[model samples]
Target: MSNGKKILIVEDDSAIAEIERDYLEIDGFEVQIVDNGPAGIERGASGEFNLILLDVMLPGADGFAVCRKLRETVDVPILMVTARQEDIDKIRGLGLGADDYIVKPFSPSELVARVKANLAQYERLRNRGGAPKDGSELKVGQIAIRPQSRRVYVRGEELTLKNKEYELLLFLVEHVDMVLSKETLYERIWGYDAIGDSATVAVHINRLRDKIEENPGDPKVIQTVWGAGYRFKA
Candidate 1:
């Protein structure tokens, strides 16, 4: 059985951190707050957090760097927070392996809502069963995916993929040869249509290619259909 959820808040601003922590704690989550990127990474590596609320602008390393490092060791969901409302920043955060993004001056209620939604999705995936025993793995040339186990194999070697990445890859594989629009993908995977920017999908696609494609510069498994969206070739 899953225990009480643990959330890590990585925000340099004490006020914002406190506000998020207070609300999440009231919702029955255990919250840990860290002020800088390096410290956040250190704590995150301990594998204690079920989810992370990371601020974009942080002291000593920045949220992107922290997120990248944390992904190297953990599969916890990361929700990036930023004061900048630019699409480029959101894309950057997603590319660095963050699962979601929220802009500053956001409604606390909405933040809590997102947290709950993400946690629910995570739990659902966790409770799902293991991979099939038959040779029915989704294979895209050299890359193979087992949906039930949430595992990816590249040339027979296991590849570590975060929760969102694995889901995105599986979705694309399941819909092989069909060009899926970014809006559709966002709505399906995130449980809501992405607002303010669609570059978040682009970033994730790029990251997924980097991991699964032998030549990310010219991806073959997950192809981008110009003026449309993305598709799986095999």
Candidate 2:
């Protein structure tokens, strides 16, 4: 049912874009490519795609700018592709609402895996709209989440969360008080082995804390377990 999902590839390099498109199409995805940022954003805003594979450096607006703009208009998953592996770049990309990041020199297998994982997860979330079987809720302290509706409320006030942020929070909440290592969290949430570092998990953790924690600087709800990883305090 998930095959033939439409994906937009916003890469400036024709060769690289073609390679990505070819691989994804071979894996049963319907792929579209644009070589510049403005065109990417324009197509993205139309909500015609299930996901987007965006390159970092572009002609009209750079990937970060394109991501920020796209997030304003659409809720589809965005995965930023770049040659830069710096933590800052990854953090910035995730902060701009990208669902994942793939550094250059990545394997075509890994790329296909990422696209499939993201599209599947997005489909699951989009389809989960019915009420829970037992009217159960996932709650940690002042934060409450209804999995069926995909709604989150902190302190009785609903808070907006991007896709990965919601997934990360739900995972932590499910295993409340258990310290989960970055590697474990990455594998569980991303549905793939960590190809690089676990910086992606750390970025999403910080973003979630900022939204649900009383003080993001001194997070009380989601505590860092010092060398272990993060724990959601229940």
Number of the predicted model whose TM-score against the real structure is largest: 2
lDDT of each: 0.83, 0.87
Q: Among all windows of ten consecutive residues in candidate 1, which has the lowest summed lDDT?
A: 189-198
Could you give candidate 1's per-residue lDDT for residues 1-234 as a string of tens digits?
224999999999999899998888888889999999899999988998899999989999899999999989887788999999888888888877888888889888889878887777677666655356663677777778877667789989899877777777777877889999888887777755435246777787888888888899998888888888888897
Give candidate 1 misplaced runs (Cα > 4 Å): 1-3, 130-136, 155-157, 194-197
Candidate 2 regions off by >4 Å? Answer: 127-131, 194-196
Model 1 scores a TM of 0.85
Cα distance off (Å), candidate 1, residue 153: 2.7
lDDT (tens digit, per residue) of candidate 2 on 200-219? 88889989988988889999
For each candidate in turn, the TM-score is: 0.85, 0.93
Clash count for each candidate, listed in order shown: 0, 0
lDDT of 1: 0.83
